[model samples]
Target: MKWKANTLSLRSLLCMPLTLIMLSTSITSAVIPVKTAYGEAAVDEQQVRTARSYQATLSDWKRWAADHAYALQTIQPESWSSNGGSIGQDKFSDLDILIPLLADKRIVYLGENSHGVAEFNLVKTRLIQYMHQTLGFNIVAFESGLGDAALGQGRIKKTATPDTMRRSIFGVWWTEEAKPLFEYMKETHKSESPLRLTGFDIQVQSPLFQNANWIPSIKLKDRALQAEQEVHKWRMSKDQSGFRKAKPELIKVYEELLQAVTKNENALKMDYPDEPHIVKLMKRALEDRIRVIQEFNELCIQSNLLTEQGDYSGAQSMMEWRDRAMASNLAWLVTEVYPEENIIVWGHNGHISKAQSLISTMPKSMGELMPKELQQESYVMGLFMGEGQAAENTREPIQLNPIIPGSMEDILAAVGQPYTFMDLRYRENERGNSWMFERMIASYQVQMPMPLELRRHFDGVLLIKQAKMPTYLPDTHK
Candidate 1:
């Protein structure tokens, strides 16, 4: 057959091994040097073969997916209430399919592309409910302020009203989509065995972080209180310029306060015998906050010093420090607070991946760290969208581009499902192709180097054909 000038010869294509062809297709850019009559020129052989092979493989995969993809009816009836309400047995039958996969896993991570997607948050709520009711998951964690989350957990344990629980939560979680989750948690908290809520981030300005004065005045001396107030004042200013200048001072004083608290932990517990459990929990949570703040402070210091020295890798290390702190806090929560309970973690996909992305320079994420630390069964599920609008860190709208060809997104979108789920763990065997284990391409506002291997990084994927932003809670812009 005649081939186009830009295409590869059939003989040349047939000469290459399928493994090499698959590897070339997985790359972000692949160029084959053609021996032209005059000089060498790059041809799109790799891209062509990748597209063709992927198309054929995807056609077969879809046939398989049709049988495997869980139907919406299995998850919930079409007439089911979107509002926070009790789900019936029929609705749970869909989630029951996941029970075997989750049976041995202690930590289940559900990740989203953006924080503002209403549908994603709603689905997360549903899955969380199923996991709680069916799989016996008791702890729910977020990439939020640990102090604030701990305070919210306390309120829920006390059987506080929904309004109180909402107020106790950090504003980042104050979206209309998040309302049902709070409602469900509030209702569940009144049960004989209640669920727990916690966070694992370094944000210090959350309401609970600002109001961390419950640690007895005797234990926290006047000097430490004054230092904390000073840091709080700077944080409230919201002036990045001023905060950068004062950050070093803030770190110094915060470290001093942490030291004081560490020294007086025994005395504080002894002084409050009746509320020992509460006091101990609060102490541990506060210590987590301190560790996170210390990490952030070190990041800032290292970044500045590195910038001055013209070494940028320090900035990347700063990012890694934050993730490490998150991982540490998560480990602490499982080991100290709820050793016997199964925990569900919610966060952006980046933080929950088990492998490094070709695009990111940071070290392994909390998802990677946690499983290794616990040496227990853990699973990660990443969410993707074919096309839609997403919010940036600054709350600006960004239109998502179409699915990239040869990527997992394109493969799943072609399945002709509005929503679909794929268990990546067993996809390799199902597809009978090692290519299925390769990195799955994704799109980002800032270009990424390459995609991450789907099978290695994620246990499962939840794909949405179209996505839209959720309604933000009042005065909570980001």
Candidate 2:
């Protein structure tokens, strides 16, 4: 395949708003320069400049950590070169440090720099295993669709295969790095305490797993699903105008489906007389299916184009709506669905941060809008990369600039561990900790250059030294 470049300077791209910049576009220069998987490729250092423009080095960060006596927890590798580790002995004994910090917590929010960073996903999978085994966190909730999760969860209940588990979650997590997590989920299904799968997003993460077709009223449900499958015929669409033209008519099908669902609500309740919760779940899922089609107009492009080309208002509304819905769905999961069970949430740094409104134009994020009681029991960890490259959705890898000096990431790197986790909770008002209170470089590689205050948002952070693109699995859905 030819290297596709969007023909824009990295500098110019960074100048754009985070909302617009995150809409994945080709950023390669087309001039070929191949590099190893785990090592940094040669990219212009000037392209990595932040607003601060500080001339600093790894030595400076080390000097700062030495001054502070900064304590760091080094995480052991589960062996990156191959999945298997020293089978008998404990490879992840380092994870014991997280126990005291998380043992008493009800929820753990794992934030990645982006959806496609393989290193983040790899460690997160281990963390999930550790948390599940040690801390009694039985549920692994993704930032996927509520309805899809509902259906996926049902499938796992029936037959928990690796494919079934992978299919239940988002495609971004469908990789060789993520294969262990999928297999683990399958393995634990027959155990006494299996990891439960769920999602909180209003958006559709997996097109393959759907549940709206199984509604109580099959005739009404099939009609809507038929219209939806018809919309998939435009999957190869290159014409934006065609989608825009048909959006209204396609939306009408869902709108009618929603109306019919509401009208027959009581009758649906009658069908599941002994199981009100199941009835409620299917009803809410039907609503989710309707809302998702409208959000993207049965297309992922619609979500990305929300902010592109003078569509700022559309983008803002969609962002606020998604965060709010995610919050509500998560709250429901904790209180209603998985009551008394601890949960681990996996999502992007933007959606998982508590200080989202403080840093961005967002009114509230999923972290902020979560019920106050549930929020009290939650701890959010913002994961970051000190160096290396990330390819969003397995596209051309964009090399990250060095960690911006005086930023949170820079300060964390000050600790000088190759892969480490630092607890930012319960620190007294002090000097070395002052970095958390300042607005800093959270995602120089992902989006939002130095826009968030760490202490105000994250309770902890997992900093990996380098990031590499994931080995994306074959397009099995195709």
Candidate 3:
């Protein structure tokens, strides 16, 4: 029940002095009165200093935006100018608005709850639009693995196969930026595109609807399943005999779930402060998850060396489950696994931040993972949506005609012309649509190029706050 990490304890020790000073001098303290806010007449000086420092960072972005508003407008949607009959590249100095925040590329860290944060949603939409339109990137690999397959693929011309993904609905309310991207694809590349979506996250199977798993594989797996079925029947059946028979299977699930939850609990407690009661229930649900994994692994293990593709029945499942099993250590893997001039991953903010999630065990900052050469070779940036700007007020979203490497010229061409958006805060039926607001916020552009020390692994960070600023063109070249 006591949630604490030794590392966190160490961090507190290092920050305590500054924290104390910040607490004493914080504006909040003065405005609220020391006694009223802290129940003390005097506050620690370090607390005040720490609070002030945090306040500055929290608003640093907005401050930066306001200071460069004129420059920002200049880097609008139609800012690019063509040199007649020659290489048409936009000037970089004129369009510094698209630089990303968080220059450290090593962490490739994004921190935000996936279920919320429209800002994250906007970023994703912009990235998808950019990659597909400009770079000719035709593949979209999702963390949701197999379940993502249900979403569909983008289009590709001259071929019966489609390369686009289906219109997705989950996690949309919070990830409002995603709506525009899908809508754009639907409208533009309704028939042709090659940006196929593939999810290696989990095997696709259904229990209620009867997926291939209708028949269990191994004897143990079958027993485990039979026991489950028996329990289900007992729960629904009109006989007491079945109830007694189902108890064992239910107990088995309870046992497995408890173990898994305990393992996860011990892992989560170091940072998250939620109650322990949830751990008990989490364990019970984990049984089904464990069974799915077990079956998938078994299938993989039992297959012959030259097994047919169809033999892999339970390989695809839920996106989250598959991602958890297959996703490598991100920082290490990004740097060492894929060998490309530049690799960009589109994921929720949570996966991209240094803060904890499904990936890391420690607070691994981006600076630590970046290789020196990459810092010299690439311009790393993260694209995030601004807090209140809309995509239109920002600019028209368009795919970079050719996904050119990150350069001052490319940035210039992308910034093209200035655009305007009206404030809809007072409008009807508007406030509930966070996606719209996210698209609006995604309008403002902040580019954070990877710092010299942390730029090797990536080129730059581009964050899109408003979803619509980037033109939503379908992958028409399928």
Candidate 4:
């Protein structure tokens, strides 16, 4: 997880004149004449001519590269200003140029390098609003727990104020900058034409009906409380010798709890027949929680077994399980919840990328495991910055270093723009167009030597000249 040093040396290695070096070696070795058919030493005229021709070709190529190396000017993006919050319909005219290209796409993925970039979050909010208003995109999915985000959505549906909705979101999205997005969603939701918000991640925030306030009847509330206590005991248990013996008991408790919740859902439905929306929302949220808890329980069981067997690598399966669960949940959302609706997915670049080019050894991202039909209907957009400040895991300020030479970011920075959008699908059929073939190589937590093929990995890239850390809201745990 170290940043690469001596980039100047790496650049020199990449730009080395291989043809000239090879020609020099050939010249030194060609001095000795070959024996002719008559046993007389003679210079092979054909071989000498071929070597001279190759040398001439190499010289021509060197001159061509020197002359055309700065051809990035030919691909300059249509300039647009991203100055403030005035990114409405009138200001979108310049960006309207991309509508035709994206019109057929069903799913548009917006990605960011880090979670705490103010500019990225702002731009994404603007883009989401514009897309939803203009392109009929209805569902907006986030990389958060389904139950927690759905609970937030329900609150919004009930016209919750911005501050209340802000507190409802879990994880990194709980920031001051994200408040505007929630407020916008609340203002936009209508009984006749509602704008839906959902999450497709696998991390569960809280179990359904764990609090007494959520259950209507005292009997049901007491049942939920007893189940929660038992589940907690199982989770906090440290007696390995009795772990296997407790599995059946744990399963029985889970099943009973699920049945109790299901019974409560039916009871609420009958009691609140005039107000079915709340009941439906609670039921869906409970179902999402159940799925996540079941997955987690299975993961714990497998990890414990692996630990007993002395195979610690099996612990990593938990991540694979989470990823697979996320993908499956997204697929279910698309097929069952919002069929025939175009969706916008927002997450970190690593999670939404079509391939794990950033982390070569990691499991396939959610986009990678998507069904082929869904894949064809998707367009992945990656966001990158040249230089900026970001927050480390410890919330300490860290700087984004200058672009490395011969990298995709370096070539884009040469365009000398504050912001630009490049469609990677554009391919040029010209020689010496290394920029078109060079892949995107980036590093965050670790130094990644392998580069992602721009055309194959991402449909487009949004490049910002500089970035700054987002202003986080007060920590929820605090």
Models 1 onward score TM values of: 0.73, 0.71, 0.34, 0.70
Q: How accurate is candidate 1 locally (lDDT)?
A: 0.62
Per-residue lDDT for 1-478 in model 2, tens only? Answer: 0101321122233223211112445554443344769675765423233443243443454464445433334333243222222122154466655655665579999998777777887788888877776567878888887756655665553554546545566777777777777566655665656676777886644542135433456665666666656555543344567767876766676666666656666754454332224445555655665665555343445544644565565556667777887888889879987788899999988788886778645657889888888878888988888778777664567777877666666666766677766666644444334555565567722745756767788888778877787877766776
Instruction: Give the Cα error of residue 188 in candidate 1, in Å.
Output: 0.9
Q: Rank the candidates by TM-score, best first.
A: 1, 2, 4, 3
- For candidate 4, the per-residue lDDT at 398 reads 72
Best by TM-score: 1
Off by over 4 Å in 2: 1-91, 157-162, 206-222, 229-280, 291-311, 444-447
Model 1 misplaced stretches (Cα beyond 4 Å)? 1-54, 74-86, 157-170, 207-277, 289-295, 304-312, 357-360, 371-376, 427-435, 444-449, 476-478
Top candidate when judged by lDDT against the true structure: 2
Model 2 clashing-pair count: 1
Collision pairs in model 4: none
Candidate 2, position 17, lDDT: 26
User: Which lDDT value does model 2 have at 379?
Assistant: 82
In angstroms, the error of model 1 at 93 is 1.9
Question: Would you list the clashing residue pairs of candidate 1?
Answer: none
Report the C-alpha lDDT of model 4 over 366-441, residue by residue, as the tens digit: 8787888998888788777777886654456777777766555655565666666666543342433334445546
lDDT against the true structure, each candidate: 0.62, 0.64, 0.32, 0.58
The reply for model 4, stretches above 4 Å from the true place, is 1-88, 157-168, 190-192, 210-214, 217-257, 260-316, 357-359, 426-439, 444-450
Give lDDT tens digits, candidate 3, residues 1-478: 0112321233333222211121333344343336565466754543234434533432442342232222323222222112211111232233222222211122222222222334454444544444343333333444342322322331221212222232212222212344454444433333233233333233322221112122233453445455445433432333344344545555665464355445555543322222222233223223433444344333333332223445433332222233444343222334443333133444443233321221222223332233545433322233333223233222333322222233222222233323211112122222122221221212112232211211221223343323233223243322
